[model samples]
Target: MSDAHVSLRDVTKVFPAANGGEGLHALGPVDLDLGKGEFFAVVGPSGCGKSTLLEVIAGLTPASAGTVEFEGWRVDADIPDGIGVVFQEDACFPWLSVEQNIAFGLRKTALAADAKQRRVRDVIDLMGLGDFAKSYPAQLSGGMRQRVCIARTLVTQPRLILLDEPFGALDQQTRLLMGDEVLRLWRQTGATVFLITHALDEATMLADRIAVMSARPGRLIDVVQTNWPRERDSRIVERAEFGAITARLWKTLREESLKTMALKGAGQAAEPA
Candidate 1:
């Protein structure tokens, strides 16, 4: 009866060293809820466990404690059909053409051949990768490769999409263009999106609501609502209200960023056999 599409009840994650040394407490006791079709953004400083949190939701990593539920069912294990993920890297297969890469996951499904082709074609056009549909991953530009990554995810038509800094490696101009493209895809597909990014401007530009996280052993600090119009453009960043919101978020994030830096320094000092 509840409509909560994704719920994290006090979820935590800790990574143990491969050599069985001390564990890294990444995130903890974080309670969050995401409604269906919501464009949610998580922003935090490096090592704040933003990416780890996303991996938890994607079922790529298990939580050290607490629970994660997707669409009312516990997500303690991988359920491939229910989720799609786009990482910061271009994860497309080098040997596969753009269309083949998009169709890779669909091969296991019961979808008709026409349906699969239609889905692949639709996302190719949606992502503006029409001309590059037959190209291998090695042939595309960085931005174009990322678009292929997105198209591969979208072609599967998963109910939830997790994006971990999908454009972080790109230049500012390409990132902005890709941001618009992502929004356009979300609008057309109506998929619930959870994106993790370090870029404040991208968060403000793309998210319906932004969840701010604290430094190491990450916790939700605040969930800021954007006052900008749903139909947003780069010009929205020029508004006084936009500046105000970013300023407040910066106030929250700056302290955490500095704290993380100090922790990193301490970590470096203590690193030894």
Candidate 2:
């Protein structure tokens, strides 16, 4: 049996003329798929629409052309039911305790109170936030707060998780720890993860496959499989294989980044028509 989670076929996004001039081409005309239980990361130059792609797939933003599918159906702006999203911003609610935040996703459901408590408790322990279950977001450190954000998303047991730079604000060491946590959750829940990250090392370290994008009007330049041991830790950074993949990731990133900058420069230098 085949298990494809999210599929984008010739998906393109174009922003309408901002100052009544010309529209901006954002992402796609790119085709890609993230399989079930797969950890896929997208990396590209700034403004390459990495987050746009995630948004499109999540059905939060509409694509101008083509299709975004989840679990076999086209997800064209209606929020899909089985997908969980964690963004870069502070998602933890200041007023809610750790347990309360984690249970937020299930509030609409009719589950019995005891069942809800068990689900919340399980995710708290799963995320290693059991110790702080009673702590509020304001009382927690940055990393711990992010863990709460993630646990909140996971408590619903979504089949697919879309992470948009969920660890971008953290320090390098903290990001590594969070990457480990994400992998652990993926293992436990068997959820497909589609992540957008700018850090090449972070992408290389955490992704099962890395999708590299080009300049604006982002296209799938290539997809490289990590296949570097499923059970990984931050210590893997010291190994030679990690260096090899990360170096290659940088090579693609640098080339695409330069291309985008050059295009931007030329566009700015040209007089408006």
lDDT of each: 0.87, 0.88
TM-score for all models, in order of appearance: 0.95, 0.93
Among these predicted structures, which one has the highest TM-score?
Answer: 1
- What TM-score does model 2 achieve against the real structure? 0.93
Residue 93 Cα positional deviation in candidate 2, in Å, after optimal superposition = 1.6
- Cand. 1 TM to true fold: 0.95
For residues 164-258, could you state the per-residue lDDT of candidate 2 as single tens digits?
A: 99998899889988888888778878899999999888888888999998988899898888897777766778988889988888888899999
CA shift of 137, model 1, Å: 1.3
Tell me how many residue pairs clash in candidate 2. Answer: 0
Give candidate 1's error at residue 61 in angstroms. 0.4
Off by over 4 Å in 1: 17-22
State the displacement of the C-alpha of residue 243, model 1, in Å, after optimal TM-score superposition.
1.2
Per-residue lDDT for 47 in model 2?
A: 87
